[model samples]
Target: MTGSLETFLSTAEVHDAVFSLRPDYRAMLVVADGFDAGPSDAASEDALQAGEAAARAALRDRPVTEVPHVAAWREAYRAFGAKPQRTRNSLEAMMRRAEAGLPRINRLTDLYNAVSVLHQVPVGGEDLDRYRGAPRLVRATGEEPFDTVADGAAVVEHPEVGEVVWCDEAGVTCRRWNWRQATRTQLSEATTSALFILDALGPMSDEALDAATDDLTDRLTRLGPDVSVSSRLLAQ
Candidate 1:
């Protein structure tokens, strides 16, 4: 696997640790890209509804609890074009809720939601074209710095130093303040090809991560014949 794949795989270890510490907690990772339509369009209402149904069925009798963070995520998106105060407040509120353990909900949100409900853990997805290369999954190291995207929206910077980050060649991509965008790259309807990373944190069983990765790969591959999918475990 390449260095990038390795980084994502390392998240499985983190998953394991988290499970060991909090056995009642579960986590999942889901990634999809290269659909006939981009994530924005490919993740249609029908798709999300179907995904949510699948997720509900999966968690029907599980001991798992959900921390839905997608709703807050969507709210952030809705606030994206609003005034600065409203935007910042909305995003910050969503961040706090996510930190407090809320499962996010979105059209594209259902994909991760299904996995999270089934696995009984947290799951997140971001548009790769919207991320900087080599994004890090770490916390803010210093004062929050940010850059504007081609859309003219600002991303909050607060990567915790020494913590794992989904960092790109440019800087942090999707984690914390910037849950789903990078200043350098942004997903658009015009996006035809892309990369995706499914990151997990804490001590998780290899079998589990593999299963998740396999399932994700299978579904995404069917989305397009030219779609390229790869997986790896990142070493801390």
Candidate 2:
């Protein structure tokens, strides 16, 4: 847990007070350099499809809710007045979309989206360059700004009070845990620096989380030449 990402998390005062991830909570942080988030290639597209197949297989006999670990995400969402059915966590959302097939975005995004569905974890990435000051997971006061694209226009919105969010001095970087990402820190084809977060809760073991991170690391490290990777487990 070092670099701009670590600095971002440590500089926030309200992080631990609001988001004391339970003793069984676990998050795998992957910070990388030399990332080329260029357009998706043939191989990347294939991998995404394969991951979608796996997701479909996982849901063939059971719904996402019965997945067990997803129950923790549902509880967390309800704590903030969000209905998990209406505002699905990243993993559930990806699983739904993956049932048919996943849309190929880019090499970086495609890889993570695939992994999220495959492992059923909430995985998200941020363009580290767009972050301002430090980032923290805190309960929103309902006044801090959040920049996002609404419809086809850029809009500034405020998060609901008690909503858990990832924020910095500028604005909210991610809202409702892993539900949405801000445009400010969006990864693009030209992005070279990136930070990825993997969330897991009770009923999910550390060994499973480690396996997911290892897979993610292996694929990302080969994203481009000279890519350097570092990872840490952020948990209780």
Candidate 3:
């Protein structure tokens, strides 16, 4: 599937408006194929457990808002007119749930979610095969359709005008930045090839983001033999 890999290399675009909104923003796009994919196994379970421990250590006795990276995401959310409290970023939401427990979605999703919490970054994984075009980050015009599940049924929603979102030619893949992912492209047990997005802001250094990326790559490599992975760093 050289063509598939090339599609990922098409250079994901970050709209000028999005960059202007937060000059410190950066994203790491990771694509992996030929790896074993299925429901959460022992390896993923252990990773989730370790990630939970790391999150607890980071939180210690502090509130989620006090975490530096989380605070940065909160500020980013506010910059786009989103209420951080009412609609939390993925990173903040994961950390808050760490005390209770993170969900065991699937091997790919679980591992990425663990890496997200372990390194204090917001990581989103999607079925690469489901994507129709190169991913792009932009300020939504409130017209893009976002397919999602609500109340145990399928539904379509739109983002508020001027909100930050990740989308493809199909529609919005993620809404309100990293707050939520669309069901249309979400990872599942049947997925063998996947795309992972690691979101970061000013508070997280390049080194920190790389560490998280490395951690994820390493874990994915160990899942099975012949796992091929590629990554690209998107920044201003």
Candidate 4:
């Protein structure tokens, strides 16, 4: 468990944190291996565009907030003192933009966004290279540093105490559950390996999550190289 999150999932460090998740809390951790997050080719870009189009068509008449999966994430946000409307979850924000035509980033980024829209789940990824240690999810102390870029200038901020966050030895990596990711672990063209976290709540069954993980893994492996994937499901 040298570099795996499972090392601390059941350890004393996370015992109290996992206990805090209410009865309905659920999540799936998907870790990919032998990835090549380099520049996308024509086919990859085309698939990305197609996925966005499908999402827009599916959510055309309804807003993201009305979607069951997206709404569940909103509840998770409120559970930690966040205003979901003001601070939209990453999936909700991406759905909005997809409706208007999603922005194209590198292959890895596009891959998750496409899968997210295809399954209507909150899919977040991090560059394993920048991560300081195994993953940890706990209540922030409001003193841990989180690095990000503001107006193109580097900045470091701290999460409010008790706000649920994903962090490591370095500092906070994601604040307020799936709301945001730190700049330090952002996936880039050079990223070769990564971890993706899929968030879910009640009504999202284990079978559905396993299917989604398979779907994403299949697509990512097709991108290039002998990509491998390992996953875990955390539910209450």
Candidate 5:
């Protein structure tokens, strides 16, 4: 995946412009596989809290503004519940846009989420090593069967075919198409190295993509020196 940084930012700019015009607009960029969920550090927790706070603030004065992507995602998960055959929804549709055709967002997941907030777009990262094999962004084929762990204790079996998914060299790394991640490949506090990704879909401008990429790279560097980040436009 090779492209100028400017190309990425331009994509982001287009999304930003659209968001600016919406009455209630919110977006989220998330790092999926980087941090260990065992126990979030105060700082990491703080960052998550800050994001929640920002979302709340955005909705404080509005009756029907755009809702934060994360909040919407949570709702989608609840609506799906624990059915035998889970399927993809609107939120997952947006997430797949980021996972497809992007260079690995290194270090479990640092760069992806950093830019997610910057661009107001929901983004995600997953660890390829933990999976059975190399991961691919594709719609789930009913023929492929998989299991995912949620909240550490509950195991969910989803038997939907043609749902968007990240297929690792081994098997399905994440099940919710893109809405929720599997526990096996999740990043941990012990992870010091990783592949990061940032995603945006729809009609986006070059400038926004550039800015988001630059901003994410800069932030990742400050967090740790061993991180490397890159980008790719999803192939249609």
Candidate 6:
């Protein structure tokens, strides 16, 4: 874990081609090690409740796409040949689901998802132990492997050419930008060290992203006294 964390510290980045497509793109990577990973408890539930309330208030009598950050992500998806209406970004999807209820997967995942909605940003939480190397945001060439489950059976899929993806040495960890995550690296109760990716566009200012990141960091830090957290913001 120490070696991988160090690799992530020096190697995570957004490729130039991705920046060429959306120069205003930004990604904040937050890594936490030695967390007390466990099931969602009172704190996480409270955060989720607050996030759901915030989403409802923000979307009052308006469509989810009208949100500034969500609108920006919509354009980004289209820029990469994906129809945002069909394949919604993580933020928009979470906003849409807020009205019903957000799933409580684990403390780590729940906390990040809550912060994501609370700040109106797209957030991805991954199990650090599952990664083979540093993570990078880039435009896929249709050759990277993306592991997922289909019909309750494990399977592999490939991204469309020019599609935006987050990958490591193993393969694509997230496909279509933030629309979906590879099952292999998803956070679970067994996860102790974790990596969180907060995706942002021009519509979402750096201050707002940092606020969200800070909220998440604070929450993670409270999980245990020995939790160690670090973060870096990548922009071009």
Off by over 4 Å in 3: 1-7
lDDT of 1 by residue, 1-236 (tens): 22443344344323233233323323333334446533433444444445445454544564112223333333333332323233332223332333234333433444444444334333445555555444344333544344545356654655444322345545655433334444444444454434444434333455666676675566566666766555554433
Worst-scoring 10-residue span by lDDT in model 1: 63-72
Name the regions of candidate 4 deviating beyond 4 angstroms.
1-21
* Per-residue lDDT of model 5, residues 27-93, tens digit only: 2222222223223344444444444444444446652114444444444334324231244332333
> Of the candidates shown, which would achieve the greatest lDDT relative to the real structure?
6
lDDT against the true structure, each candidate: 0.42, 0.80, 0.91, 0.77, 0.43, 0.92
By lDDT, rank the candidates, best first: 6, 3, 2, 4, 5, 1
lDDT of 2 by residue, 92-193 (tens): 888888867887888889888888877878999888778776557788899989999989999999999988888878989899888999999988888888
TM-score ranking of the models: 6, 3, 2, 4, 5, 1
Clash pairs, candidate 2, are 8-135
Which residue runs does candidate 6 get wrong by more than 4 Å? 4-7
Name the candidate, 5 or 6, with the larger lDDT value.
6
TM-scores of the models, in the given order?
A: 0.51, 0.91, 0.97, 0.89, 0.56, 0.98
In candidate 1, stretches whose alpha carbon ends up further than 4 angstroms from where it belongs are 1-35, 39-47, 54-123, 126-132, 147-164, 177-186, 201-204
Better of 2 and 5 by TM-score: 2
lDDT of 4 by residue, 121-205 (tens): 7788888777776677788889999998889999999998888888888998888877889999998899877878887666567
Clashing pairs in model 4, backbone N/Cα/C closer than 3 A: none
